[model samples]
Target chain A: MSRLTSVAGSTRAIRATHKTLSSPWATAGAIVIAALWTLPTFGLFLSSFRPAEDITTSGWWTFFAHPRVTLDNYAATLTATSGITVPQALINSLTITIPGALIPITVALLAAYALAWIDFPGRHLLFVAIFAMQIVPLQMLLVPLLRLYTGGLTVGGVAIFPGFAANSMSDGFAQVWLTHTMSALPLAIFMLHNSLSAIPTEIMEAARIDGAGHGRILRSIALPLAMPTVASYAIFQFLWVWNDLLVSTIFTTGKNAPVTKILADLAGMYGQQWHLLTAGTFLAIIVPLIVFFALQRFFVRGLLAGSTKG
Target chain B: MQAFFSWLASLPNIVQVPLVIAAFLVVVAVIIVLIEVAPRPGTAYTWVRAAIAIGFPVIALAVFGLEAGAAWVFGLGAVLGGGLFWLDARSTKGRGRLIQLALFVSPALLLLIVGLVYPTIKTIVAAFMDKTGNQFIGLDNFVWVFSAGGNGGLISLINTVVWVVVAPVAATGVGLIYALWVDRSRAEKLLKVLVFMPMSISLVGGSIIWKFFYDYRQGNQIGLLNQIVAWFGGEPVNWLQHYPLNMFLLIVILVWSQTGFAMVILSAAIKGVPVELVEAAQIDGASSARRFRHIIIPSIRPTIIVVWVTISITSLKVYDVIAVITAGQNSTSVLGYEMVRQFSLMPPQSGHSAALALLIFILVIPFIAYNARTLKRGN
Candidate 1:
């Protein structure tokens, strides 16, 4: 009777310990890390709202004691006497980003279709070659491509592509489109090919029996099924192009430069003006965040769909 | 008609750009016409059918004289012919078999020859040429890169090594830990979003934010980080100007940006670790820590390798952080930044830039090969 009683007591004690230790600690720890991770962006957001004097004088957190908000920084950024406006820069960013995002997806889709479904001689070799190109650092290609662009794709003006002179070409929206498209091609092909290949072969064969040619099969079957992945990749590529400053800076100059380049210039030229810089940075982020939330459903589904399954 | 032709001609490069596009479009239109008129073949069109199938681009180029500029006109013609081979994909076809074979492989062959194979060969040749690309330098630039006391020889090498070693390991480790810890939590989604928020900020924006955090001054504290230090009765330090640590600081920016990717990938892998295995471990008297080490780690090893190598390749090409933050000052130079600096900023020293670039390529090639091999094995 005493032994039975001891066993019951120990069982109750273990259950009680498990209950006390498990739930609250995990919840609390997750909350803490989440807060820490988000704090810098939050700080920047708050700092952007405050006036320049208030920001320089005190921390963003100090605004709780004396909350003074103003739109003067944004107003200046919009209609400055220096003449390059925020809205105009934003339009420039869109011009680069829209095409930059689209060209790769279109090209990659076709290439991926050919790679996944279409069997031909040297197909495997082609896939391997394109995949290998992914590791050729983007920076390495900058000079060679730039030189090619300027010198008419030739050796010492002996025309490789006559009338396509690099020096004659201007830094504008066109440059952004070309550079982003070329750079995006390899990864786009690799990623889309994987997603495309995951599609069951039997379904494609069935379509073929239904009298659908390769183009018809691609249109009626593969394209629709691959939409979610394509959309997700499009979002990823869009966000990348939207947020990319380095590529834009390299490919574009003068008035055609995007908001990212402008933000860099703002920080460099007017480091003291955190209020303005913060506002500018926030402006740049707004579109991307909107895009993120808009595509959140497709985003999560697409990410898991491509990487995890086949 | 004249107005339209003039407009087309004036749009861009008449020879390579516009004419090629025009020819390509015409070929596409013609293919659509053919599909409308010609009987559809069974077995999804053979090689010949496929070539003719996609021959629009080639037809467009040839019709508009775009192919005239290229050295591979005959190759283009052969590609256009290959489209006819699509009909002969099967031996039972009534069309000429020889014509079918030649036609089927033509477009891909032409595009490969003109678009890709030619340019790559040309780039290789350019790498060997002098500044004006007038004469061969005979590996002079490659020699300079490895030679002692060459400009950008040591700092770039050391910085690149530090980056490749430190960034990947740190990013992957932190990412793995975070993914493991957060895998089961209620706020897992929110945590991921917060981590990923940095990814939305353009590299330039992150650079600005970090620049503020590391903003230096001798007299007073204006930056957020410096102000916090002053609040703690500490002195403000020039974070970006400080050597060795500054490189690590730059690496932190990459870590922040890339951790989301690592976590997302590893988190998926963790979720994939079969629930039965964990239960099995528990029944065998394994503690939570032991379960993680044995069950979780072993199951996700492949994913860990993937994340590690992918991040390593990215690190090899890390330029923006170093460029925007330090601009290769205070000995924080890496290969990617040095390439830009030497070629674009410095007086067009293509040789040195190309050499530095080649080194980066050589280093990355082995990792890429390993990745490809592992992927092949996995598949």
Candidate 2:
């Protein structure tokens, strides 16, 4: 009883120490750091609203003195004709991201279930292999994977699998989608397996004894239990695919390019055009921002669980 | 109905995206349903399953057009469907478990084999071949990579070393400091969001934001960095044009974006540090700095290493930022950008690109090994 009281007393003391630690200096330092971190983005965001002349000539901070705002930059960026427009890139982003996120989760959930619950040969080896595959950087796979998409896989001069022929926009979408799904699987399976395997074996055994097949058990029990994890991973993968520039730049054509690709092109070709660049950047950023703020909790949970890249 | 079909076909591609995704989802739902219901004790259901499985390829062919690619899909689908039907038939006779395992696992395994594993092996092989990937020119590509000259592989190698070393350390240090400061403080959530917001922005967007900051106008200074320098009676510097400083300036963009990631992960780790240990140390008359150094750092060392390695790997693969900001000009070329640049060349130096990729893969191996060791130890 005395030991328990002593432990409680220490906890109270620690709480008091925490309060004292948050001195005025700490607060001021934090505010300064926050301002430094936020200023660049804030400047660009504010510049996106300024007129083209003002944005190019005066500092974004000068906007405080003048206080001018206009949607012309956004209008011009969305309606530009020299290249792929912002709206078209937005559509392409959705096309790539939705299926890119969904297909992997569906495939990984099944794989995770089997790895977690099924009594199978080589299960541990397979799990370890998938885990290791998570570290295989995307660069290692890009060249050959592109070949596999453009030219069929061949062994000893015999074609085993005919490659995807990108004759339409959907085919381009399919290539990007397949690439994202493949890259995302290892991490997805690892994460979902961790969560699914944590489900009590006793519950699984009880269901098995009641004559529930694996499919039924997965659908009725494991799926519901793992839905939170699945949701979090979904949000993570969605943001990842949306924010991705490397894959989309390599995979998609002009019309099928996502917003990130278009934005990169704009930044490269017209670096001096801050008005269009700023608005285009914000337009590209808006969707992920919405998803981030709306699902920040799940996103953070998934990030902590699986911190590696797709 | 005919008019409606025509209208649907005439809709813009943007409008068709949802319909396409919906169709894709329906196909996935059908597969799931087939897996669930195929084992039912009914011959009628089995026949229906077989019919639907066979009919899917036909529908795919019809929708995608009767092309050679569709023919391969048709053949593959028929074989896969037949195999599944055979398994489903035998599943009731004490083979149900194996069938379920195969059904649950084969899609993922097949995709990984075809997409990741096969391509990795092929990349390793292509690294030995010539520019056309047809001739065996062993070690030549690697020689070119390590060749010492202007904008050569050696320079890229040195820059990457600098990047991997400096970016992760600075980002992790800043993140650790921020996490410590904001621990249990008021407005913690808001403070965290300000830092973490960049994690959501595309690297492309982040580069654009920083480009504006590094923008150097000769006359009246527009860029914040230049304006501040002007305030202190300094000439406006071309931040991205200077050689060694340009590399570090590029590194700053990565640090700014990734500091949030490090902070969040380290903040979680800091929270996980035992309060009782700290209190005990306090009772022993340890100062706050001593408690932090001895207690908190040791407790979260594993997490810090993980965060550092994760960021290092990201720094190694830093492509989009370089591609956007400098396009590998001013001696800022790194392995990731060089690999893509080599591959995208007119003749397409497949061997050189492959060599660069393999180098990156080799560099990454140690990090993964360390991570695996730590994971096993933790377990």
Candidate 3:
């Protein structure tokens, strides 16, 4: 009887709150804001489908007056003979993004496990250092890191390390993959550490008492429990690397550039090619858009876990 | 082996992608398995570990095909692996913990040291050096940065300040309002997705979308903004060519993309507010506005600060939107793009670039500190 009353009381509270929150003014305000936020992208999406001449001649909103559509823009952009085509750049993006997400997650997971479960000296200090490193702007590291990549490390007229020579496409890929892995480590370790440390101590202690080593416990118990966090972070990193423009532009050259860099170049150089630009931009956006809508729950959860852990 | 690798590389991207990913995963898996099994208490396991540690580097040497750096790789790997094995062998029951910690943490530490830490120090040193990064010419680059002249360093610095100040406040305010207005409303999820969709697309893609919106043609008014102007019988202005207006226009793109982030985070924080407090306030005849002002805002203040600081840091590092829209022309350059431009100039002004970079870092420090403080307080 008490349980039923509690359920009824909770529903009453929810209804009351909803009534108070959903006044006409608020509803109207939300609709306006949502429209404002969405219209530009919607217009762009509409234009991407319209015929090239129509897009060049009229505003996308004018589609109502003269509705026409074609896939020729996508075809043209994907098969353009002049520069790096959209398809090649798309492949490059995939190649860069996959290992870019995987390697960092692997490295960060191991470090997070050690920092969370292992009773080591200076662990707190190390964690704090890595946490602080998150604030180091990528600009600070870019010049020196690039120089190191092309010119190597030298001190007192002695070469401490030989720099990477990007003589081939694979070598270039390796350079980008390593750079992304490095830059992503601090935040990845911090977020994973937060979740790993939150696993209850009783379970860990029980496993330890059962003669399970750290690796066994981590692989069997902690990993399965923390899989959701890992998956969320993976999606976050995947989208980030996929959508990144600056790093790829700096690290890659010519045909090796990712889709974002190519799209940016197209927008810059071929500003008059509206149809091609629109199609290419949409193509670049399609993958992350799918990932965003599909894994949105995990993405938002990861954002919250990373930031609002306090 | 060379023939095999060349064949692998020659495969189409569809096949090469999985092949490379599979190879990477296999290597990582092997390392993990080796680490897991190294602790087994047996002579055979010890012998196996020793052999793998010594043999793996040799295999790497053979696979990579001897080059100038071959000796460096082989020597470094052999020493690192052999040293790690020696430590593992020496450690008995309780002492193995430190070695285990080292084994797990070394990859991340080594990468951070090489990629972030060392580069940071090198950048600081380069800031004090000449354009070629050879001679020490102290503070000249910094002076140039603050100097009032045609270099536009002061202009970029002031623009960065304006961006950092205006963008975050506008985005956070708009996001907070949207979050409040849409709270528990029907179609909440769809409404949220509309506002949040911008966060998924690349900044370059967002820039293209907005660039089309701001596009100016002489006759027909292809752009939406100009179309509205034309409807009102006004001249279609060249929006991006105007000086201060152009900067704000570029900022609009940042706000457009980042408002989604602010909204999502602040929305979550709003949901986290205690319902009982809100209900009690409502029962006390507090108006919705009053309840929001008193109850809701205070509850999510920490989150508000976090979102604000996070966006501020992002604003300070704003590059892609400006790079895509204006290419930093018309005096719209901020520190982020300026650093890149300086570094990529004809002669490559390394000192100025490094100084600009260090300046961005210094600008970011306080926001991070404030964020950490609020996080501690929230906890």
Which of the numbered candidates is closest to the native, going by highest DockQ?
3
Query: By lDDT, highest first, what's the ranking?
Result: 3, 2, 1
Error of 2 at A75 (Å): 1.4
The first chain of model 1 has a TM-score of 0.87
lDDT of each: 0.67, 0.81, 0.83
DockQ of all predictions against the true structure, Cα-based = 0.22, 0.41, 0.48
Best by TM-score: 3
Cα lDDT for residue A273, model 2? Answer: 88
Q: Tens-digit lDDT track for model 3 on A199-260?
A: 99999999989988877887899888889889999998999899898788778767668989
Question: Model 3 residue A245 lDDT?
Answer: 81
Please give the TM-score that candidate 1 achieves against the real structure. Answer: 0.83
Q: Per-residue lDDT tens digits of candidate 2, residues B1-379?
A: 1222234335665665576567657766665665666455566875776665566445544453334434565677678766765765665554335545665787798789977898789889989999988899989888888878524577788899999999999999999988888775788889999999999988999999999999997788779999999999998999888899999988999999999999998887776666778778989999878988999999888878888988999998889999999988888999998889889988898898888888888888898888777766755
* Cα lDDT of model 1 by residue, A16-58, tens digit: 4334324545556656756655666777888888887877776
TM-score of each: 0.83, 0.90, 0.92
User: Which tens-of-lDDT digit does each residue in B1-379 have in candidate 3?
Assistant: 3344446546765676677678867766765665676566667876877766666655654554445544666777788768766775666644345456666787799889988999999999999999999999999999999998838577889999999999999999999999888876787789999999999998999999999999999888789899999999999999999989999989999999989899988886776666788889978999988988999999889989999999999999988987788888899999998898888889999999999999999999999999999889766
Q: Which residue segments of model 1 deviate by more than 4 Å?
A: A1-29, A80-83, A154-160, A163-166, A300-309, B1-129, B218-220
